[model samples]
Target chain A: MELDLSVEIAGLKLKNPVMNASGTYDPLRYESLVDPNLLGAVVLKSLTLNPREGNPPPRIVEVACGIVNSIGIQNEGVEEFIKVKVPLLRKFKEATFIASVAGLTPNEFAEVVEALEGVDIFKAYEINTSCPNLEKGGVNCALDERCIQQVTKAVRGKTNKPVIVKLAPDVTDIVAIAKVAVDAGADALTIANTYRALVVDLKSRKPILHNVTGGLSGPAIKPITLRLVYEVVKALDVPVIASGGITSANDALEYLLVGAKAVQIGTMNFVRHDIMIKIIEGIKKFMVDEGIKDIKEFIGTLRT
Target chain B: MKLVECSVTHNLRVRPEYHILGLECGELGSIEPGQFITVSVDSVEMVLRRPFSIYRVFENRGVIEIFFKVVGKGTKALSELKEGMAVSVLGPLGKGFPLYEGVTAVLLSRGVGLASLALLGDKLKGLKSRVVTIASFKGRDADLASDNEYVKSFSDEVIVLYDEDRSSDVENVRYLLNKVKPDVVYTCGSKRLVRLLKELPYEAYVAWEERMGCAVGACRSCAVRTVAGYKLTCYDGPVFNVRDLIL
Candidate 1:
């Protein structure tokens, strides 16, 4: 028997249950490796209002089974993304393009969303108020309810497309931020961004990353991410797109069992360019072997 | 962008700190010097790719060799790769050193940067240019002869400069440069020596290493702005004219 693969988060229906996490995979760079049309949705790297060169060197450090990135949201800004990236992404047939935006201020966020008004390819806008990879105002915008509500309200007022707030796992109470975002008119929630972490080279007596602080992702943070996804799914009424530490289809299934509507694959993309495909295939195979039908039937099926 | 698993043919310790990893490229030998291939160690343990320069690629043998130091977890994992173990590698990319016949001189390097000149010396040799392999390091044993033998076969002379401090190594390099003055100069590593060469009257080419993304010139992360404006180090050069650089 064939297993169903269609999934929906908020009002958006995805053909499959897998997505390329924001800032993890670049389609233009690795298009030849995999068929972009086969993807459920492609979340582009974080875009700011103005072009950013990002942080200094040694931006990434590989740990024991994980990776840390302080890329600082290095992007080509909305104007360039709209001019260059969006056009190329729109050419792909089946993949839904979700543009992820990061800004220094709420107004900048709204401005970028506003600028994206008429451009047709994007299915949604991911408001990244919490990126541990950056040093400044991006994460600060989601630390408190006031900032989260304000930024969400500002962007929500400007765009007709669905806006999903990507939250930080580093926050004290993620549910509080999720409540604020839901109340402020967010369409969905991407719970638990990379947690701020570090690694020191004992010989050099200094941190490995050039920024000193970086966002940790991969298998190392899987447990924490599941807890966050579970907590948010229990607290908020909005859909939660689980991310952080998702590597395989079983990992994605684990997230779904815990209450994630869908899952995002990050650092794993660097190693195997077609991991998304493998995960998608693996999820289908699991469903077939387990005698399950539609993938959505198992969504949040985990019992306490 | 096709991801294919290839087997490691040779996995041996070239030195105390370095490993010589050879993989079967099999009819895939268009890579240039300074251009690196990204390798994946394991699907679960190491997620991100570790980039390794092309130490040498033999088209007839269908072999691609990489020389890497055990610096961190990724390198540590790579060092443990046994012969016949399957590993994934993305291909020959980035702009290599320009091949010009009758080029005056060549300067080799120490460390993994020796991989940066794998194809360069061959190109210079084909051009019938005089070359010098100046082995600069902090008291490394002379018995470590993997690619050194390949370089020696192509160069005209050899100079060994051993100093721990990089600035001191630059001064020592100046002493040798004065002795082997030539019409043109090319270097793989040693930015300090490259800077020192800029102060001299002779024209020199210094290959600079930078953090890269995509390595195909799209990310624009490895751009180094010189007097001639910004140029992507990955595509435009891992090599650049010494006088053209601002620093």
Candidate 2:
């Protein structure tokens, strides 16, 4: 039987369930290797109001099975993204682009959404709520119900497009925050962001990352993130786009089996630039072997 | 730059600390010196590809060789790679050193960083009446016969300095720079050297080494802080003008 890998969430249609996690892949750079037309959606880097220089190096350290990064979301801001990037980005006529919005405040989040609303190329917006909220006093961690509510509502008020709230997995009550975001008008939830982590230099007796602590992503966090995703998917009625450390079709399948509408490939893109193509092929082979006709029938079908 | 999954043609260990990895690049040999390639150590345990300068590429033979030192897990795993083992090799990525005809230039490098300069030195020697001088700095144990021979093939002169003697000291290095007084100079992966070169009279460039991710400009992990915001060490340059750097 001919298998169908297409999926839809929050009214946005994806040709397949594979896409690069925000900040992990660049379409302009990788387009020569991995065709953007084949990916479900091209997720760009997180954009703030103004251009950011990010943090000072050393920003990343490779540990056992993963790496920790404090990139500080260095980006060209929404204006530059619309001006410099969009002109080049428009060339990919068949490619669906998803903009990741980040900000220091709720009003700032909506402002970015408003700035990008006129851009005709974007199909959706993925909200990176991991920014340090001025009112919250620390990294939002995407867990504060009041903050998630305001950020989601403010962003929702500005655009009619889909708003995906990317949450952090280190929190005590993810389901509560996920529910708050859904109620506040988030059309979807990227079940988790990078896991909060730290690495130290034995000789200097200091942290490796300039920011001291960073977000960890790779195969190391796959199992832990899968569990967190399972819990969130079981509780929320809204769509959940899984994002922790999906390196393979098997990992993506596991997330889909747990009810994730789609999966985002993160750290592995650094290891192998053509990994998404291999994964899309791997998922296709899996469907042929399992006699699955369409991807929707296979999603959320975990055998308990 | 394209990603090629090629088999290892050779993994010749120059010493316990250094090895030269060779992979078959099919019709993929258009690269300049100081340009780098990120090799995915290809272990699930490793999260990022390790970037190495293009030591040599034989287009006819369809082979690309990378010189690396075993400083960490990535290189350690790369050292164990055998002939015919499949590996994911990306690039040749990032900017290479800028070249000019008939200009006197010096290749100054530290330890394994010498690999980044050899290809450029070879190219510089081909130009009309250009003088190529190599000033290599090594630690007590880092001095290798192969390094001397490799740089000697294209360089007009070779001056070896080591930690065993203070000849490689900043003052001595400054004195040597004045003696040669070349039109332009090139260095590799040394902050002290780059900083020193920036204060000198002649034009200088550096092949920057950084902890890289995505190798493309995507992740922004390997950022080199410049007077004009930040540039990615992997994408913007493995080679950059000394004046443009804040180091």
* Estimated TM-score for each candidate: 0.90, 0.97
- What is residue B221's positional error in candidate 2, in angstroms? 0.6
Chain B TM-score, candidate 1? 0.86
For every prediction, compared with the true complex, DockQ reads: 0.43, 0.85
lDDT, candidate 1, A1-304, per-residue tens:
8667988877788988789888767777677676777888888888888887776666777677777777767777889988887777776867788888878877788898888888777889999986332334344666767778878999999987889998888788888879889999999999778888898989899997778987888898999989999998888788999998887889999998888888898777776778899999999899998888998889988988
lDDT of 2 by residue, A99-201 (tens): 9999998998999999999998998999999998887786463867788899999999999999999988888888888888999999999978888899999
Ten consecutive residues with minimal summed lDDT in candidate 2 chain A? A135-144
Best by lDDT: 2
Chain B of candidate 2 achieves a TM-score of 0.94
Q: Local distance difference test, per candidate?
A: 0.77, 0.86
> Among all windows of ten consecutive residues in candidate 1 chain B, which has the lowest summed lDDT?
B138-147
Q: Candidate 2, which segments miss by more than 4 Å at Cα?
A: B129-131, B138-140, B145-147
